[model samples]
Target: MRSFINKKVQTIKPSGIRKFFDIASEMEDVISLGVGEPDFDTPWHIRDEGIYALQKGQTFYTSNAGLMELRKAITETLSAKYDLNYSPEKEVLVTVGGSEAIDLALRATLDPGDEVIFTEPSYVSYLPCIQLADGVPVAIPLKEENEFRLTAEELRAAITPKSKVLILSFPNNPTGAIMLKEDLEAIAEIVLEHDLMVITDEIYAELTYYDEAKHFSIAALPGMLERTVYINGFSKAYAMTGWRLGYCCGPEEIMREMIKIHQFAIMAAPTTSQYAGITALRNGDADVEAMRESYNQRRRFLMHELERIGLPCFEPFGAFYVFPNISEFGLSSEEFAMQLIQSQKVAVVPGTAFGESGEGFIRISYAYSIQELKVAFQRLELFVEELRARKQV
Candidate 1:
């Protein structure tokens, strides 16, 4: 078996996010905040559309690129939301989920040893995906002071002559940080200077807490449309996580390669899911806003409680997570999380699970209900009190 396995694949570690999540699942009465998934169900209308598709016997495979109708709808949604335009026939690709789009983008572009620069404390898949594609992974450590936003200076420091792509995930998982439009301009300038392409994941785009503006995509910037792969999906926004639906848009030349790989590897996305996706794009705004409001409430409540408990954490503006500094407790992030689960049955992910840069922090998700959060907070407060008492001794 050792001889049969690829050595590179053997070097990859399993996802740290799932380790604690699976542990909590086995325990009794534990409130697990380890996973970043949404708690909401797929909206009635969206689910109804899927049911309708099945009833209509639309089980046949769609074209390699996906149903034309679904592809066109995806382009319309991007254009209307972010002023991004794509040719439905050539520039857009429907994937199994945002994860597939990410893998596709990496595989389509990277050659052996081409460096892909991405920020640390990012989605767990980026580094491994780069390695699996035979590309080198270059990680730039993001700073808490910068709200976890990637700075042009940090990006420049990581770039080498072989740097070919940059991966950006805003409304970031684990940290919940987001990059505003002006913040993106600086990095976009650097990418252009280095002639780098970007695979921007906006899966959490609709979950941003900011007012006065919708989420901004770097693909919309001047000269960037041809230089970026914009990835998004219905999982986060429409509560369609299990539907396994997502899409990507990029230049025709790049997308052509992605589609060919997809055609062979996947054939097409789920037909029922694609039909449901069309309805989600056209009529799911109200459902999205309602869920966003709920996540915002939970986020605020957790932030206030973390403050009241005297735990220091950065204020997150997007996603449904809070990354709090627990260094004063004098425990490793994994130790704190494990002891909290043992003593209080409240499970959170160690920040170091994201990257080495996430040391001294822990990521708690607010995707659970308000009542569940309130109970978890009570246990968290008690845990902190006990740690303080031990310190005094």
Candidate 2:
């Protein structure tokens, strides 16, 4: 019975982030900065809307494409934020989450042996999703000197006749790097030159902290909207992770095929969540800003503390995580993470969870409270001191 399982699924590596977090979960006392979600509870207004929907017996399935009201809200929000527009009827489909949208986009587009190029040190799903869709996954290593941003030159270098799609994950998960308008403009030219379509995961788009330049979408570029599948959700921005709601917008031809697969597979996203999502998109701006400011404060504190403790970390201006170089401590990212958990009772994610390019670094999330962060760093300081002393011995 075990042998009858799909070999492709069996051979895939387990998520490194979850592996250590599971271990820490069993312990008595652990200060974890490993989970990539908002520490805040979902805003009361949004929860009240969901409660209202349930009271009104909205437990039934929405349209296979999702609620028209939610879809309309999706179009309005995208237009307001990124200047990208889509028709609710034919061009937008709400999925389980941004993760589902990624899978849907890949399955709808890729033929077996088609190539999908993505940046390394990205979220965990891109490679596995491409492989599951039977597309070849190509990783373009992002450089720290470039602040971990994907450059146009890298895009041009990775192109081939087989390259069919690019997975653009920005305001990135572990790295917290974002692409500005000029940065996106340069890449748009190369994408046009290569004749590639894109699956842009902008789930973290609203959480950016860069004061000088705001988050920009490549899909908003001239001539690119038709060629891009844009993904976003309420999880990060509205502190709505448990709600499991997300939406995708793209050309009608692509979206039509995606909705077919989604219809049979998921049928529809949660009706209650769809109702909640409509409220989130309409009234959650102030809530998002409050949470973003909180995360930014913790981010600044962690950055300064890591510098004082002699860990050179890349300064991130987006998202809520910091990728710090831990090479000087003479340990692999996994080793440092495990030993820290055992020795100091603190948990952070190993950067290698993202990709091999993330070796010698760890990802510390700033999504926790300031009190928890303060305690976690205190443990981290002790852990580093002990490691340094042992290396000397």
Measured with C-alpha atoms, the lDDT of residue 63 in candidate 1 is 91
Residue pairs clashing in model 2 are none
Estimate the overall C-alpha local distance difference test score of candidate 2. Answer: 0.93
TM-score against truth, every candidate: 0.99, 0.99
lDDT of 2 by residue, 1-393 (tens): 979999999979999999988998999899989999899999999999999999999899889999999999999988998899899999999999899999999999999999999999989988899999999999999999999999989989999989999999889988998888999999999889889998999999998988887788999999999999999998999998998999999999999999999999999999999999999999999999999999999999999999999999878989899999999977899999999999999999999999999998899999999999999999999989999999999
Give the residue spans of candidate 2 off by over 4 A. none
Model 1 root-mean-square deviation: 0.9
Cα lDDT of candidate 1 equals 0.93
Cα-based lDDT at residue 134, candidate 2: 99
In the range 1-393, model 1's lDDT, one tens digit per residue, is: 799999999999999889999999999999988888899999899999999999999999999998999999999988898999999999999999999999999999999989999898988999899999999999898988988999888998999999999999998987999999998999999999999999999999999987756689898899999999999998988988898999999999999999999999999999999999999999999999999999999988998999999998888989899999999989999999999999999999999899999899999999899999999999999999999999999
Residue 7 Cα positional deviation in candidate 1, in Å, after optimal superposition = 1.0
TM-score of 2: 0.99
